[model samples]
Target: MAKYTEEEIRNFKKITCKIAGDYLGVSSMAVSIGMRNDLLPIGFAIKKDDDRYSESWSYHIVDERLIAYKHGKINELQIQNIEKNLNTIIEQFEEMKKDLLFILSEDVD
Candidate 1:
């Protein structure tokens, strides 16, 4: 896999499994399980083993993959599931927007 510099990473529009799940109208755990079971494709996994409490891991999926999925390029099963759960995905997106607004409104002294 190709390695990206910090600056490149900063500019990249990466999404987490949790957020991907939201986009897919599924739970984060379902997304995780799919990845583990090879039912989903991951562009790469970044591991941060230096954390004291527990090893931190991040999965990066290519933007193209997401776009394709959004455009019905994925498997039939996924397409069906996504269509069936569209409402949930929209709700998640709304909730995330609210959360972002709240965070941005905080007073940072």
Candidate 2:
């Protein structure tokens, strides 16, 4: 697994909000509001392909240094590991078995 530096994570967040606001039809401020109100769920903002029903990427910064990625559930121990600069947060960073759709799509659908 590739470990992302803090700077990379910041850039990724900027890009994510841009994608969400420009293409996903939601403003970055709106996303922030949602998060403040416990509305953004995982603090994830994403752009999706309606035709394919697929996500590009989605994320939420659990803290100043940690981000939870698309299509996977982040665990507490994993978060701690990342805080310790362990690079790889979990045994698996991405999972194919669990459907994030059923969980996250309630905001959209």
Candidate 3:
């Protein structure tokens, strides 16, 4: 991955998945999946449920975190913190999923 200066990254109105993926020499889907799975600490990946059968992903990357991740500056402590946060998010998502399922089942009945 090539290192990007803060100024260069700040110039972008939005740091999209494609832009980040290009810098990291990976496809946009790879970037999205990485972020979703908490393997990449460069950004936030939110999965949006558009309907019962469709979902889409949205990403919001922190410029500083992207630069730090690209430059290999993310410390072990930060990684641990990210993991902790990821776990919490997973738990919350599970709860939300269960609630949605219950609501849908009621509609089906």
Q: What is the full ranking by TM-score, best candidate first? A: 3, 1, 2
Clashing residue pairs, backbone N/CA/C < 3 A, model 3: none
Report the alpha-carbon TM-score of model 2 versus the true structure: 0.26
Q: In model 2, what lDDT does residue 49 have?
A: 55
For residue 83, give model 2's deviation from the true position in Å.
Answer: 17
**For candidate 2, lDDT tens digit of each residue in 5-105?**
54565566344443433332467666556545545443444444564655353445342323343324565465455555644444234343245655677
Q: How does each model score on lDDT?
A: 0.64, 0.46, 0.84
TM-score, structure 3 vs. true: 0.63
- Write the residue-wise lDDT of candidate 3 on 7-98 in tens digits: 87878889998888877778888899999998888878898887678787789988878888888999547978987999999999999999
User: Once superposed on the true structure, which residue ranges of model 1 sit more than 4 Å away at CA?
Assistant: 1-12, 45-56, 75-109
Best candidate, lDDT-wise?
3
Cα deviation of 61, candidate 2, in Å: 5.3
TM-scores for the candidates: 0.42, 0.26, 0.63
By summed lDDT, the worst window of 10 consecutive residues in model 3 runs over 1-10
